[model samples]
Target: MIWDLFVLIFYFLVVFYFGFHFAKNTQKEDDFYLAKKEIHWVFLLLSLVATETSSLTFLSIPSLSYKGDFRFLEIAIGYIFGRTIVALFLLPSYFSGNTISVYEYVGNRFGKSPQKTLSFVFTISRLLGDGIRLYVSSLPIAFLMERMGISISPEILGIIALSILSFVTIIYSVFGGFRAIVFTDVLQWIIYIFGGIFALGLIVNQIGTTTLLEQIQHLETLGKWKVFVFDYNQTGDNSYFILFAIIGGAFISIGSHGTDLMLVQRVIATKNLVSGQKILIGSGIVVFFQFLLFLCIGSLLYVFYEGKSIPPDKVFSHFIISEVPSPFLGILVAAILASAMSTLSSTINSLSLTWARDWEMDKWFSPRILSLFFGVLLFFASLIPYFLVETWEKGILEMGLTIFSYTLGPSIAVFFLAKDKQNLPISGFVFSLFFLFSIVITVAIGIGWKLSFTLLVPIGFGCLYGLVSLSRFLKKN
Candidate 1:
């Protein structure tokens, strides 16, 4: 236990070193936000993977496979298709100008009001979505505290964890900026991936190779290896049904990768259009394989536990705490922190950039100041999940994805609207947003429709576009 704690401390020191080291180079807004547009495609690719993976991927994905099968890979399939669309269509426009925020393209295409509105939407969505991610990341910390005999309510423990994670991340982010974020993300990606592989190897070693094969075969018999579900029933919210999963996944990808400033900022920071396109599409493939690795970990975990009735969300964390040995356990815990911090840092930087650049807040205050302010806001925002976990029944992965689904659809819809030659009035955009929100609230909360969360993206896209078009037509008539 002592050795494990030492390892985690050492890891944080190393991350801090990277932050201070990079601080010297981040002297201006461009450096703080875009890394002077000098990052290589390979680095950007790794950063994207790291940033998006978060603690949810590290902790929850395995639980997914442990409880069910590999149907989640269907969404990964849709991710590839969705990213392709973004590469072909969105990348060109993003690269056509020297905009810092992705919303700039919307502003250029439509007007400033729409750009600000989109940025605000992005901010709120990222706050809520990544806030949930922050909470998910806190789970392991809370568990570790309990093991250490730190007696406190789970909520307080979560707050302590959030404070530690948010503080270190904010410091590095304020000083190091985008370059530091990208470089550290690359390092973090390696740590967590290695940790995951190591955990899987440990499980394999414990199970014995021959027995592992038999166990897998037995699992196949139990339908645990089922990857694709072709359910045709559309009367209910079957998210994993092949068509909904694929189409919904694609739209989600479009909204997240193409429209969201957090991921888009990485691609836009690359050298050229081709580099941006390469990294964007390449990330989807990498993510697919990454999910495969974690899902397989979950399956083997099921085998290891001999079908113990473990809560899917707690499966991996439970394994880490109870099953894994000391110092190596610390390494895995550090890996979880790595995943969490990477995303948190990315969120801080991206949110700061959007606020500073889109709203022209940079004119009033320094970039570092804005970064600090948003970091604090995000820290507070992350604590929200403590109040929400009781009412929410799904795992952290699903919750985070659902939060993104709420805003991503309309945000991406605006981009699609931008492609039209006809000017979409600001009033029309406002009305469209209102319309989309009403439908989302009605389906998701008011009536509690069984609509799949995956479909939210497409549904939102259609609502926003349809209303915008109708508004334009009505004005013309």
Candidate 2:
């Protein structure tokens, strides 16, 4: 206990120090909002990694990996190609436009409807998305403490973690804002990178080199690590799904990678197009492999505990609590805390910036007022743990991922098509928006549907509607 306390103190101090470090220099909206638009390519790379390698990714991807090797990777492959498209194609428009909120550019390109639609969608999606992200990532810590006889319920555990996270986020975000978030993210990158790598080494050290290979051979024997799921048998995984994913995956990436303020702010902070583009591309390469390391760690955990009655998602936590040696336990705790807090802080700061900038909610409500409302709303949302622990567990895991599809997919489609000189009318935006929501309703009825499928069903109809409407408009004009 003394050791854990000391470790937590060290972790807290490192992050807070950086937050305070930048707060001193922040003096205006741009500084707090866009890091004064002065971050270099290096910081952009770190921020890009920080935005994705959030607490959620750290917790959930390993769970996914422990379940099956390529399921998460399959999604990630499609996602990464989308990132490449954003880096090369869409990122420059930020430079050309010179606005902080990327959605603001949409309003200029298509119309006010698109801008407001995109902004509101981001708000709704992120609240749920980041809320679950906050709740689930910290679950491991709470669970670990319980196993160590700390005596706490998951509900109480959820509050404790959310409180600590909220405090850190509020403090830093109110103090320094964007520069603080970006600058501090680099520090988090170091901690997460080193911590995960250290765990990998320690796991390997416990199992000798020859023995590790033997374990890997065991995995090969069991057929756990294949890269591709190609089914030439015509009934295996289905190629139509693959083709849809490849295309739709890119679209999802545009919404997440290009349109997300968490990332757009980072790229906008860069000095020029070339530097920003390289950082965006380089970050994609780092990101693809970052999760690979987590998946590999999941693979190692399988070998270490060859035949235990346990859950796949719990493997990493189990290793920490029961199997990981002490002393390094302190380092490991610090790493988990870093992953959890950095993600929370960055996200909180992001939501703050997004609302404070995009909504101009400041015109109506004070920052403190908005914070109070958000802090309360999120508290309720985090209790999703109780439900998750109870009857809600299943194969879907789509609630958090799919919420973005309704509004985000259409907004992204409009932006992607409209930006490179494609013409979309005010009414076209209306048609696309209508099509998006109707699909979201049916998708709810058909739970377990993938985001790609849900999004495509609407987008295809929206495109057809757009073309017909455009022809009618041409005739009238």
Candidate 3:
């Protein structure tokens, strides 16, 4: 208990220092928003890397790898296709706006309704995402400890850990702004990718040099990394599912990079379009390997727990609890904090930026006042950790990502068609509205209908016709 509590105290002190350290750098709204567009490709790469590898993925990848090394390879194949599309289409769209709220571009292309509607979706979706991660991250760690005879309530630990962590993140974010978020994330990213890899190496060394290679061979023999679907003829999980993973991965990448404000906000800090593109392309490359590295760690865990009784999510935790030495435990905690900080800081900063600009609340209150307003709201909001956990477990997470199909898809479609052109007619809203309505109806009918037809049927036909007519009408001019 003392060792663990000491670690917690140490984390709070360090994180608080970074938060206050960066607070001075954030002066104007621009600094708060995009770090004054002063970020470099290296940091941007790290920031992007850390953001994509959330704690959930960190916890589960190893779990899946441990349970069946094959699953790691299977799922990572989907990420490859997703990252490819993100590098190509999504990166460009974000720079086109280079402004607050990626959805503002939707308003420019489509209309006001689409922009407001999409922002609401992004905000709510992001809350669910950040909330879910914030609530659950500490729980997994606590569970691992109890198995080692360290009794602790996950619920209590989650609140305590999250509150302090969230407070630390909120400093750079809510107070210092994007500079604090991205720059600190760049620094912290080192502890994670490197520390995680080093831990894997230590474990491998402990097992024998061939341990990793043997596991990979074992996983391959079981067909773990196969790209095609599990049950091809099921119609639901058919061969075409890879196509879905690929296509959906492509579109979803755009939805996140192009539409989601958290990521889009990060790109605005680039030196220019060229630098931004460099970061995107560079980060995409890093992600391919990063996923492999973590998944390898997971696969090794799969080998480690060949006959043990433990949850898949608990594999990495088990390793940390039982294997990691004390001095380096602080190092591991640093990695965990880095992962947690990357997500929390980005979310809080983005949330503050959204409120200040979109609500035009800035006109009424000073930045200090606005920051206080957001801090109070989020602090109270964090109290309902159960709702976040329930929503995440109940599939609200994937749905939140799915909802982006409405705003981001049309925005990209419009951008593709509307380049070097004048204002789109008010009828552009018709297409946007169609996409929104289709997604809403699909979500309302429930997840199955969404998976089946929400996107492909209505918005597909509606946007095709809208763009075709739009092109003809432009030619007549």
Ranking by TM-score: 1, 2, 3
Ranking by lDDT: 1, 2, 3
Mind giving the per-residue lDDT tens digits that candidate 1 earns over 94-168? 888888898888878766777888888788889898888888888887888889999899878889989998999
> What residue runs in model 2 are displaced by over 4 Å at the alpha carbon?
232-245, 364-376, 389-399, 405-407, 420-423, 428-477
Q: List the residue pairs that clash in candidate 2.
A: none
What does candidate 3 score in Cα RMSD to the true structure? 4.5
The C-alpha stretches of model 3 lying farther than 4 A from their native spots are: 1-11, 68-98, 144-152, 210-216, 225-231, 235-240, 366-435, 444-446, 449-477
The window of 10 residues in a row where model 3 has the poorest summed lDDT is 452-461
lDDT of every predicted structure (CA atoms): 0.88, 0.66, 0.60
**Candidate 1 versus the native: TM-score?**
0.96
Write one digit per residue (lDDT tens) for candidate 3, span 345-443: 777767667666766666776554565555545555555655544434323223334444444454445444434265544465565565455455444
Q: Flag regions of model 1 displaced more than 4 Å.
A: 234-236, 425-447
Error of 3 at 434 (Å): 3.6
Q: Estimate each model's TM-score.
A: 0.96, 0.88, 0.81
Clashes of each: 0, 0, 4
Rate residue 319 of model 3 by lDDT.
80
The C-alpha local distance difference test score for the whole of candidate 1 amounts to 0.88
Residue 111 in candidate 3 has what lDDT? 68
